[model samples]
Target: MRYSILTLATQALQKQQRWPQIIAPEKLKPHYDIIIVGAGGHGLATAYYLSHNHDINDVLVIDSSWIGGGNTARNTTIVRSDYLLPASFALKNFALQLWDSLSQALNFNLMYSPRGYLDLAHSDGELEHFMLRANAMCLGGASASILTNSQIAEKIPALNLDQQSRFPIRGALFQAEGGVVRHDAVAWGFARKSSEKGVHIQQNCAVNKLLTSNGRISGVSTHRGKISANSVLVAAAGGSERLMANAGVPLPMEPINVQAFVTEPIKPVLDHVVNYNAGLSYLSQSDKGELVMGGATDGYLSTARRGSFARLEDTMMRAAQIFPFISNLRLMRHWSGTADIPMDGNAIVGRTEIENLFVNCGWGYAGFKATPAVGWKLAELIADGKLPEMLKPFALSRFTDGALIDDAGIGPYPWLH
Candidate 1:
């Protein structure tokens, strides 16, 4: 049933009992044209585009747990394209553009809010650095500008703008079009649309290993059984390392735990997505008035979906210092997800050593924002057997050839990313 005002009226009159399930269960076939190993946003979006745009309907998406039950649903859904590098900005800005029309395109409400995004600068050096970043972002097709202390104060009145405070706010880089979206809604929308187009989605069915032959791709051996595929795309964020290893290819990435939390519901306090550069913390107010917040990674390697208390405490402390009102709020919930951070603090999206074994992992904590573009480009890559120009710089080959797209310029430290 297509969702609309008329459908809503009919459903209400019918007592809403005729609503169909989002995705129906289907038995897996022994063979498929393409198989995606993760049912997260990126994987599902790729399947959707493969069937919708490329007319390749014989696709299957298998996940260990449930659809979007991984980082897709675990993130604090901040989306932005104000990156300092050209490649990163191009891919991300494409996704940001797609985000604007995603709800209508998928016939689902993704709840995308383009309030704005701010990166606070506490020192003069940081302000100068932000100026350089803003110029790069503007040149790369993202709307960015540097705002002075008074301008930032006008934007965020709750911020601790006093110069006497620790890490005083000096200025900021503002991207007026960047904001947040409903993370799980993206997963569900893509899943429902893909299932409608005859793509298969299997949950609780893990791919134990990648089955390869003669340096080419064959398929995957899953918990249920061995399934055959002409091509396989492993977009399984944190778990990609193990799956790639199964294909005899080593990924230069580390999966580390990242945590986020929300405060109890209150009146609307924050409008724009705010980031404290000195503290390395970020936050935004949800539609429900809950202050959604997150900070740095655990600074170590781990696949566990749990974070250390010390890191959480440090983040909250930084958040409280920036916005004193946070001190009065009680915690609503806290959770963590593992991100396969690359050595250069950037994503690795391209073909592996195996001919037909493609990958779209190592996005770290930025996967949610890049979902639409990654899915679209990955679908094209699989369909045309070529890498998109925007994705070339992020290829696995860059790590070896010293062409690392280190957006953070933090060296080859995945932990710090």
Candidate 2:
């Protein structure tokens, strides 16, 4: 059902029980034109774009678990495009543009809030580095500006601005277009629209191995049965490495655990997403008034979905340093997601060594923000048999050709990325 003001009134009058399911479970198909392994945000969004944008509806999205129950459900929900590199800036900026109208296009309320983003710097040198990034963002046609310490103080009065404090606020990089969205809503919206457009979504069906008939394309062997497809895309995030390895193509990516959590509800105290660059932590406030926050990855290699309280304590300490009020709030919930960190910090998003196989992992913590753009471009790549220009920089062959787009200058260290 299409949601609107009238639909709300009508449903209210009928006791609100007539609303239909967002997406219906589908039986395994014998074959499909395209098969996407992983029904997370990128997978579902790709299915929707394939049917909606490219008129290719014969697509199957299979997941071992329920849709959006993977990394899609385990994120801090922050979105932004203030990247320093040109290639990274273009892709993310395109995603940000799509985000402005996605809720309406999908006929679902994403609860997107353009509440701005503040990257706090602790020293003059750090502020200068942010200025370079801001310049790059503006060059790519994205909005960004520098904020002095006084400006940040006026903007976020709840922040701890004591000059004597360690890592005191010196300045920040502010972007008006960066903010948060309802993460689950993004997955559900795409799944609903994709299902409505005749795309098959099979949940609880794991793709165990990649079945290639020759040096070219073939199909996948799922838990249910063998399903043939003309092409396959492994956008499975953490699972991409294993699935691609089944095709004899080892991915230059490693899965690492990243954690995030929220605090007890309170009256609104934060209006913008704040990143403590010095402390390597970020935070924002949800609609329900919960302070959503996170820090760096686990700094090790692991695929486990659970997080250690030790890391959570470290993140909480960082948050308390900047937003002292958080020290008084009780922890409501905490969880971790497996991040597929590529050799280079940039995402890998193009064809693999296998003829008909493509990859779209290595997004790390930035996957949630790049969902729409990746979907739109990956669908174009499959339907048109040519990679979109925006995604060429993320090709898997870049590593072999020494064309690595290392946006973070973090080298090929997956754990550091």
Candidate 3:
């Protein structure tokens, strides 16, 4: 049933007790045309695109946990297209465009807000670097501007800009089109739409092994049973490395733990998503009035979905320096999620060495922003068997061809990226 005012009225008349299920569970079939591993936002979006755009509904998306229960739920939910590289800028700009219409297209309230994004610069060198990135973003069809210290102060008056303080604010790289969205809503929206279009979503079904026949993928062996498929695409994010390794494909990605915390609900004080470039901390105010904040990775490789308290303390200290008003805010909750960081700092997407196998992983800290674009491009690649222009630079073969897309110029370090 379409979600509209009439349906809502009817439901209201019925005492709001007999609503239809958002997505119905289905029994495992003998075979499928395509089997995608991982049921996060990216996987669900990929399935939706495949069924809706390509008219291919014989697809199945499996996950070990429930939908939106992974990194998709742990993220700070900031979305932006501002990047220093042309390739990344194009891909992310496309994603931002998709986010604009995603709510209406999926017939769901994603709560997307284009409140803007500000990347604070604490030093003159950082300001110059941001200027270069801003120019690149503008050239790639994303709105970006360099904000002076005075303008920054005017825009975000609550921010502490005292010159005597440590790491005083200098300026910021402002992207007027960047903002935040309800992260879980994105996943649920796609899952509902895909399921309604005849795509199967199976949770708690962990894939144990890749089933191959004579050099090509035949299917996957899950904890439930062996499911056969003509093609397999792994969009497992942090779990991508292990899944691919099981299929005898070694990926140059590491699973690292990244942490985030949220403060108690308070009056709205922040208007835009803020990032401290020098301190490596980013934060935004949620619709519920909670201050969501996060910082850099723990600088180690682990599949554990938790971080050390030391890292949390460091993040809080830096966050306090930027937003002094939150110095004494009571922390409500904190959590961590694993992200797959590639050596070159860019995502690894497209067909792999295995003939019938493909991968869409290694997004690191940028996955949430790139979900839509990645889904559209990966669906196009799988449906038509050709890499889209926007995704060609992210192909896994780039590592061997000596073509690395390190936007930060931090060479060959997964954690640093």
Give a tens-digit lDDT track for model 2, residues 309-379: 77788899989999887889999998887888888877889888786898888888888999999999999
In the range 160-192, model 1's lDDT, one tens digit per residue, is: 888998799889999998999999999999999
Local distance difference test scores for all models: 0.90, 0.89, 0.90
Kindly list the per-residue Cα lDDT of model 3 for residues 1-417, writing each as its tens digit: 789999999999999998988887667898999999999999999999999899999999999999999888889999998887888888889999999999999999999999989999988998898898888887787789999989988888888888788798888999887999899999999999999989999998899888988989999998788999999999988788888897888899887889999999999889999998765889999989999999988878877777888889889989888888787799999998878899988999999999889999998878999898889989999999988999889989999998999887886988776
RMSD of candidate 1 to the truth, in angstroms, is: 1.1
Instruction: List clash counts for every candidate, in order.
Output: 0, 0, 0
Which regions in candidate 2 have their CA more than 4 angstroms from the true location? Answer: none
* lDDT of residue 400 for candidate 3: 90
Residue 304 in candidate 3 has what lDDT?
77
Candidate 3, poorest ten consecutive residues by summed lDDT = 298-307
